[model samples]
Target chain A: MASKTALYDQHLAMGAKVVDFGGWDMPLNYGSQIEEHNKVRTSAGMFDVSHMTIVDVTGADAAEYLRYLLANDVARLEVKGKALYSGMLNEDGKVIDDLIVYRMTDPGVSGEWFRVVVNCATREKDLRWMAEQAARFDVALTEQPELSMVAIQGPEAIVKVKSVLNESRGRLIDSLSVFQGQESEGWFIAKTGYTGEDGLEIIVPEDEVADFWRALAEAGVAPCGLGARDTLRLEAGMNLYGADMDESVSPLVSAMGWTIAWEPESRKFCGRAALEAEKAAGVTQKLVGLVMDTRGVLRGQQKVIVEGVGEGEITSGTFSPTLNVSIALARVPAGTGDQAVVDLRGKQVPVAVVRPPFVRNGKKVFS
Target chain B: MSDIRNELKYVASHEWIRDEGDGTVTIGITDHAQELLGDVVFVELPEVGSDVATGDDAGVVESVKAASDVYVPVSGEIVEVNNQLEDSPELVNSDPYGDGWFFRIKLSDASELDDLLDAEAYGELCEDES
Candidate 1:
């Protein structure tokens, strides 16, 4: 069955090229992919991310449930409207998904409530996993199907968003610090994004999302699709869960060591034992970024070889539009970041290994 | 919008062949091939004067998404190579049949054109893909 988002009609009205993405009708692109990529780089671009799954966990045990479920501690989100980025792990300490959890302020409504947003492709599995965990606890978890989501990203996103709302709300939105959120009426505005840029992800009623999308489009925001979104995120060193890591890949090797909070020994989370064991024994393979020097595009599944270790596969690879170079994220040997070679058929091509984030905020992070 | 010129023949892998009106033939990839690959970031052209059998991998074409092998439509000897793609690989995406034509060859057998598909048949073959 093909599911339709609130912006489906709007996309059709704009003559977008629609495709089925994870069972939902999505706009692959309004027209030219290169044009959309250029728009996000030079100006502003908005994506219809309503296909993503949004869930709300309420009750006193909401934070406690997240602490037990997520690899990162949600107790660090002391300030209301602050968002935390964390990875959900399986029993083997392997990352199931990476998500952003927003702690909403509810001093009067119904107590402290937190909004959890996950990838569109992993919606069902994420919800199922979350529900199973909730069944073990007393947290009230509800999927937010009533609300639609959109992400306006890039350099000119702020300017375009500000033009839609009133001066007060506009200024309030611009005043939002990174990883912060605020609710105005039924609209939830959070300064969060996957693209390495200063932007915001806004949530509102389903019907209202189309209207908001129109207003944003009219305000000069380009309607970008999954193509540009993939390139943009890859250039930012962000991982797409199913492509970069899944239930079999651990965060210790997925470049998520900093996200794990280990201070409080009392707070034992799911997969903690395995992660500790892996940490103590040492992980052989780690995720690293590759910059191809041969001018050919690097793609996923391409073989990478270190001196001693045999071979590794490219987890996620793409041409970095921002850096104007072919880059890839690969799971190579732990000590292979210094240098590596990607097999271009029978020929071995030298590739520079470095910390990812080839580009950020419209600037090339790699030279 | 590239019409299959009557002088050219095509293969299922999306390469075109030209029966050079002699005992030789010329070959290059089709426009549809480059379109599927998006912009051509790199081209690994085969060595000139090398023996290329029919359906043999002449070179590799790398795009934003994946890298694919360009197969020889007919057995031949590489007579010409388009060094133009060495710097401006986008030409393959912009003009797969023209300036982006990968290479030309002097065929071991010009009668091999009979084994290739016609323009209309090639179009039908492409349209059938999922």
Candidate 2:
């Protein structure tokens, strides 16, 4: 049997089609995935993101431990509640997992705390890796499995969330900046989301999550499922951990090279040497966005043929609800030109290649 | 629960056929099939002159979640395809019986229609799968 979130019953009551996702039985969609996708793009939609793994690292060496464990430098988080997206890499510079680390305390302070949220599918392996790394430092890792998360996203998301929150908590949320979070009334409210929209991801006590979800539904925030989440993230050009990059893939070729902080050369994070070697050896492949205006949808694992260049494969692909066209992320030869053909069931369909983030702020960014 | 039209003929594979009495049959996926596939985003139709054997893969219907093959229910030559689905695939979800019809086939074997299940039999098949 698969695991269930706190709101599983609510999902069933709302006519959700549940599927096994990352060992958890989660909602794929309630009815129409396109409607849910449009809800997030036009108004507001809420998702049960409780399947994500949250870990709190606290100790005298908390900051130091994160610096050594992550590909990005956490030392740059000057203010509390500031979050940084980083890749937890293996010794060979391959990404084990990509996570968001929030500075729970002031930087450079001993006995500080940092909260890390990782993908649920990689929980077991990621925990073991973190424990093994923490053995060398005076840090303690505490998994927050007792918490349930809800991500409310879109143009009107903040207002809808504010209406459902208490006045004080609402004010606290209103004062938060993008990528910032704070704990209040036993809840961690963060102004962060994966849909490239204005929203808040609230972490609530497991027992209270159902009521919160109900309140959001009553407040007119559509209860979205993982299907909408995937499409929304794809349109925003955000990468899915398992599909876009895996343990065997390096960050340099995964469109995550910017997350690697190469400054302050003395800071030797894990996979630094290997990443440096790969960079020096010249990265041969790159992840780019593909748009198909004609018929047929682009799907993952589809073969992409770039004329005069080596073959590449799609990492993540879907019919974009926002653009009304099929879009995909493919890892192609580094020097591939601005166009390629995707083999869709033996039919060669032409696609235009561009930098990712096909849509942002509910608008098409790529021409 | 999905609506099973009594006037139509269905196959175990979830396709419904309507004999137009002119040796050509109109075909579309059942309501249950569209429900399972969710919102249809794209549909690839067979060419007008292509010959298709019963149970052979004739076309495709892609939704937001995944793609599914629309199998040919009876042996025939493709006579016409729903071209509107190329630009507006949601018709399959909104009106699977009328405008959402996938293709029209000129029957090579009219006896094949007798092999299809009536509304009652198709309903039982859907129940078994559920």
Candidate 3:
């Protein structure tokens, strides 16, 4: 049987179409997925993202261990509550998973703590990998399964979330900057979201999650499902762990070269040697965004022909609800130009190869 | 449970046909099919004044989740196609049996309708699939 979250009953009561996602029963949509997508773009929507795995890392070697384990430098987190997006790579410099790590405490604090949230489908392997590496370090890994998370996103998302919070919690929301998360009254509220909007991702205790969800609903926050979440993340140009990249795919070619902290040549991180060698040898493939103004949806695994350049396959593709057009991310030959054609159901349809982030703040940002 | 109109005939593939009593029939996907497809973003219909064979690959319906191939139920000449769906495909989700009708066909073999499932049998098929 698939596992159920704290809000499973509430989802059923709200007429959600439940599907098995990563061994857990999650809502796909309440009714119209397009409406849910529009709601997030125009106003506010809340998603029950409790299936994400939360790991607490604490020890004297917390910072150092993470700096070596992840591609992103942890030393750059100069302030408490600051979150950093990183790609966890295997020894070969291939991406294992993408995660957001938050510095939970100050640098000088005892048992310096950091929190990392990874994808639910990759939880077991990630935990095993972290422990295997921790055998040589002084860090401890603890999985917090007692927590449930909700992401309130869009223009009015913060206001709706704040309406349900107490005075001190409300004050905390106001004080937070982007990419900042803080614990208040047993809840971790962060000004971070997968959707390209000003919002909050709040981690609450399992016992309080249902009631909190109800309160947000009463405050006029639309209940969004995983369907909307996928489109939103894709629109924001964020990569899905398994779909965009895996252990066999290098981060350099997966649109994650920026996450590699190449500065300070002395600091050696995992997969650094392999990445450096690949970069020196000249990376062959690159991840780029594709836009289709014509009919038909662009789906994953479709062949993209770049004419003079080599062929590439789409990693993630869907119809953009905001722009009323089809958009996708594909791994193409590094030399590919701005023009390409996708073999859409046996028809070679023209498409424009552009930079990612097709939409930001609910507006089309891609030219 | 999805609503099944007793007056309409259904195919196991989820297409519903309504006899217009004028030697022609209106065809559309069933409500159960629309519910399964989530939000319909685009719909491809057969061209008007075209000949289609029974069980031929007719058109396609693209949803937010996936795409499904729409099949021709009976051999006929397409008399008219729904043009409103070009700009508003959500009509398929809003009114699957009414305004969402895909095409009207001048039946070449009206006997083909006998092979289609009735409302009761179609309900049973949906139940079995679920």
Best by TM-score: 3
> Weakest 10 consecutive residues, lDDT, candidate 3 chain A?
A104-113
Clashes of 2: 0
Off by over 4 Å in 1: A9-19, A30-32, A106-110, A309-311, B1-8, B18-28
Fnat of each candidate: 0.60, 0.73, 0.80
Candidate 1 structure quality by residue, lDDT tens digits, B1-130 = 4455666789999888767676676667787776566656778898988988988888888776578899988887888889998887878877766788888888787677788898888888888873
lDDT of each: 0.84, 0.94, 0.94
The count of residue-pair clashes in candidate 1 stands at 0
In order of listing, the candidates' clash counts read 0, 0, 0
> Where in model 3 is the C-alpha error above 4 Å?
none
**How is the predicted docking of candidate 1 categorized under the CAPRI scheme?**
medium
| Cα lDDT of model 2 by residue, B1-130, tens digit | 8989999999988999999999999999999999888899988899999999999998899988689999999999999999999888999999999899999999999999999999999999999999
Ranking by lDDT: 2, 3, 1
Q: By the lDDT metric, which is better: model 1 or model 3?
A: 3
Q: List, residue by residue over A195-248, the lDDT tens digit for candidate 2.
A: 989899999999999999999999999999999999999999999999999998
Candidate 2 matches the true fold with a TM-score of 0.96
Judging by DockQ against the true structure, name the best candidate: 3
